[model samples]
Target: MTPPANAPTFLAQHGWEGAEIQPLAGDASFRRYFRVLSEGRRAVLMDAPPPHEDPRPFVAVAEWLAQAGLSAPRILARDLERGLLLLDDLGDSRLRETLDIAPEREIELYEIAVDLLVHLHRQPPMSGLRPHGLDQWLDEVSLFPDWYCPAVGLDVDGAGFRDAWTAVLRPVANDGRAPVTVLRDFHAENIMLVDGRAGVEHFGLLDFQDAVAGHAAYDLASVLEDARRDVTPSVERAMLKRYKEAAGEGERFEAAYWALAAQRNTRILGVFTRLWKRDNKPHYTNFQPRMWGLLERNLAHPALGPVRDWFDRHLSAEHRAAAWAQAA
Candidate 1:
């Protein structure tokens, strides 16, 4: 992996002086991060060049999480103008990579994750971390038809899919009470198991630049219906119930769970497609089948009448069969 032209000077100007920079391999995005070793200490240098990415969101959200007592990679120094930052190296182990340790230990580690999410949701709504405006959501969600359909070569029944998405999402995005903090990508891969003061626990929250105020269910849906791992049905149910008990009952809260799951899963469909077509990342293609199952799960709720009907008509077995062939 080649370092971008300016990375050496950029890292050196910051506290990474005399540090040896080496690429950290294996990620889907164009962003490149490095392991900086110096004086028996280590840090990470995140290099995000423009057009491909903007580091402002990560900067903003990391500060927010830090204020909330969550462990974010501490910014040792930065040159935001050049898109470089030396951060505390949380370590090399991620929760996904450590799952083989012990089944009971894995479950315990994930429980801490559930708690972090609950704490974030309890905070008052805030906007700087995520794209929160209704117009923004509509504009972003609307792009699904444009990007996803063509990417996989689906002769998308565009009007059909759009209508279902609108029917499923409009209510929550329009409501005042539906608002809550959301860590848009709360999942295993972004978490690292660390040695906590009390005991061994997961630390090092990463890729949370998209945290924002949204429907309470948004992050929960991200956790339960993850993109990277197939968490079992029993685990999913247990987590959902724990959250429900923690958040307590209200008709609107329950309704938001179904509505938010539908909205998030729909967005995942568009995102997964874009990853393959625009980003040229094929690994995400492996998850399309499960993504469809999530879509269907959302539809099964009676509140999603229009979504259910749309899936029955559009993304049925016949539709996927053709789409898979096109993808191949």
Candidate 2:
């Protein structure tokens, strides 16, 4: 494969002249990653181009996670002006891949992830982060009408959708409880299970530049209600119980969990659809049915009354089935 245009110059400038660079798997963003080998030393390079992506947030969040004693990749060298970062190579054993090979280890891996979240929530909020509040939630869900709905040949009242969601989320947003550091994309794909590290340090975090001050339950929902894979009901129940006991937030936490799960699932439906329709990455549509199942399960909770009612009235089961079929 041809090397990136800037890789040679960037590596040379960093004293990694003639290093071997191999492409690593990329996610749903414009950023690309490469594994660099120089003098038997391995590190990862992130290429985030300007006018499309920025690396500042990733750098800042990495520092914060390290200060909090977590396992974020260590930055070795960076050129933010050109959006290149040389980072510690955290290995290739993603938790999802490990679970795929050893299905029985699902419970163990998920437990470790939950424990990490419990530790994170226990820490005081990180300063200078934006809140993932009502507006952000609505902005995400609006994609349903703007992109997903159209892709499926259905018309939705976008304004009405926002108004209804506002009513559903206002109580939680105005509860006066301070927000926690929410790693917005905490899931199997972004979490690595490193060898030889004890406890939470064994879990390597990724794609957390989108971190924000949000309800603790939001990340909990992201993990248990994962869009990429099936999480058994038994595992979900156990993890929730463990988190409740560890965090000591009780019923309020439970309520918020379901609410955020509902919101996250709703937004994901739109996001996956947008990925297929706008980004030309059609594979995301394969997860729509799983996402829809998770959304329905979360909407079952009484705390999601308004949002559930809106779905029932506007997007019926028949419509959902038709939309899924069309998108798939």
Best by TM-score: 2
Report the Cα lDDT for residue 260, model 2. Answer: 78
How many pairs collide in each candidate, listed in order?
Answer: 0, 0
Ten contiguous residues minimizing lDDT sum, candidate 1? 193-202
In candidate 1, how many clashes are counted? Answer: 0
lDDT of every predicted structure (CA atoms)? 0.70, 0.86
TM-score of each: 0.88, 0.96
* Reference-based lDDT, residue 315, model 2: 81
State the lDDT of candidate 2 residue by residue for 1-328, as single tens digits: 3456888798999889999999896778888899999998999999988968999999999999999989999998998998889998899998788888998998898999999999998888788899898888888878777877777677877777888788877777876667999999999999988888989999999999999998888999999999988998999999999999988778877887887788898888888888887798888888888988998898888888777877887786776755557755
Q: Give RMSD (Å) of candidate 2 vs. truth.
A: 1.5
Candidate 1: tens digits of C-alpha lDDT, residues 241-310: 7777877746666676776676666677677777777777756667777777776776787888986776
The list of candidate 2 runs beyond 4 A from truth reads none
